[model samples]
Target: MSPQEKAGSGPAKAEICRAFSETADAYIIYGNMTDPDLYYASRFLASDSFTYILLASGHEILLVSEMEKNRALKESCVRDVRTTGEYDLRKKAAACRDASFGYAGVIEELLQKENVRKAAFPYNAPAFLYEGIRTGKAGIGVTLAKSPFLKARSIKSEEESACIEESMRGTEAAMEAAIDMIRKAGVRDGFLISPGTDRPLTGAEVLTEIDRVLTEHNDLGDETIVSCAEDSADPHGKTYGPLRAGQPIVIDIFPMNKRSRYFSDMTRTVLKGKASPELTKLYEAVRKAQEAGIAAARPGVTCADVHNRVCDVLEEAGYDTIRSGATVGFIHTTGHGVGLEIHEQPGVYDNDHVLVPGNVITIEPGLYYPGLGGIRIEDTVIITENGCRNYNKAEKVFEV
Candidate 1:
């Protein structure tokens, strides 16, 4: 088992320790409010800025607000948690004319106490914090290094996989409820009618039902798509308006667990009634292409190769990608990695990323046409040593 799996927590501390050893004398993270790296490092959610420093001398320190210091001490991964008050930031701020420079001076004093002259930070660090470090009189040198941390986060631990799987279960249940709503609706005057009501069903109503189900399971459906017909042709179109019978309806749900902070994505195209010959052909082609992509995703396989497999299957069926100026075919990449962020790393595109065990990715193949609508089949899976284990359990039936 890897160190991350053995720790039963987030990434191993040794990993961070090694980053400090190789990247610089110390590694610093300024804020956890929107930084996944800080959250990963501390294992605690902070809505404000805090300092997280890991020294090459095998020491970890977290400087948080007084209101959060006790909570951080209890919930954080690191052992040393101190409040900013302990550093006398107000007294230090009085020394510098610029408030930003004052904050940097205080941090510089703390680093000097530890004898740290060289440090590293995330490449996407906040501009204010980067400027502070650059202008501070401590003469500390900083390197923008994010690759080591991103690489560590790319391969998930067993516990992280379980969290993702649990999130997928709730997502799949919500998808089932949405499809059931469509399956039980009555067809009237070329529009789907809500059961026991004369009003026509709308995509908004379906999305409402989906969100209701997800909320019940402690998941939030953010920007869920329940598009139909022409709307479905545009991949990211918002769900709206009345639903018509015998037309393609693309239902894509990406829900995140409120507690675990992991996301799950799944999509399926369904028709209220019989589908036209052209729509049926498109659905079959997309489904086969998705299967090809999934089959090609295995340990030691390159992500580009997996994407090419899907493209080959689609092109052979007389549908080419939009990149080739074809308006109604595969327009997007095959898949992407999923974890704390909906889109993570190891993107399954025409890139050189090699698939490995513990990598969780998605395989979604789609085909869209202006007049006929769109068809997409997606499932989240984990790459194993030999193959991938698919987490999506929803059936792929076009006609409801």
Candidate 2:
């Protein structure tokens, strides 16, 4: 069954309407494809481009192409799905020289039919689209409003949490497979050797294995990081080159489920052989800092408080942060919310946002030393009334 079939007047729609009521007469979205806001508003996933309008009267409408009208009617969250052809878009386009204006004319006609005088749009709407709507004959006024959909999406429902957990399960399985490969590899001349080949293993080879495992679970890894040695010092560095033993290797994997569209993020630093004394010290510090951040992630706690606690742990270890300079020590935010998008709201930084139940977030702490490398540990969790529940079960071992 489609998502819309299982959904029954969810709170997302009510929250969106409440936000819209405070801003404009109607909330309008126009796109040739699915925007994150539109996907959240309507639980219906559209493969093709379409327009969605939600009125203050609680009526929802979808204006789609004739090719998708039937599917929209059967699968969309909105009951009133109509074809743009019904609005004479093709006829209007034939008479008008400007295609953009012609499309806006059809939209304006629909708004007038609904008696909508002023409409609110997402803040990222294109300037051309805004100008087209404002210049239309309907005399409609447009305002670029911050997406109310994001506020509704910040808190997960039981069903949403379950979907995220399922995604995390697959992520952990893939992560375990990657770690297993590193554990069983033979060491030759301070480099990790491939199991089947005598040649040294490369970061691309490990990432290929990771993607293979994720594909088996119907997920895809985009820009997955598997950096080793010097490359690990740069947090967002892409994976490359041969793997070396007795050095830090950061494997940060974030994969998205093809079916649910939810994502899971997990990071673990491992060494194939014995870790150097300095590397060991860095790992321990990061692990303890991560624990402190997790401990602070409870309902009613502020995001700034959690970040500060993690910083305290790292600073106490005599490490520097971005506040000192860009080259070393603790950098980046503590963590961020994960869902349909890998990074979302309630960012665990020096922000004043309060943690609430149903808020799913990540607690990642890392320290980087120039020339020595970097060590990071991360886990996704859901905030509960008392504390947070970790979703990742992968063991945190510095040396494999």
Winning model by lDDT: 2
Off by over 4 Å in 2: 1-11, 32-34, 323-327
lDDT of 1 by residue, 267-302 (tens): 999999999999999999999999999999999989
Q: For model 2, which pairs clash?
A: 32-49
Judged by whole-model lDDT over C-alpha atoms, candidate 1 comes out at 0.82
**How would you encode candidate 2's per-residue C-alpha lDDT over 1-400 as one tens digit per residue?**
3444323365666777888777688888876433666766555666666788889877888888888877777767778888878888878777777666677778889988999988888877766667878988779998988877776677877777877888888788888988888888889999999887898888888899999989998888899999899889988875578899898899999998877778889999999988888999999999999999998999998999999899899989989865455457998999999887899987998889999998989999899877999999999999987898999988999999
Which 10 residues in a row give candidate 2 its minimum summed lDDT? Answer: 1-10
C-alpha lDDT of residue 45 in model 2: 67
Query: Which residue pairs overlap in candidate 1's backbone?
Result: none
- Find the candidate with the highest TM-score and give its number: 2
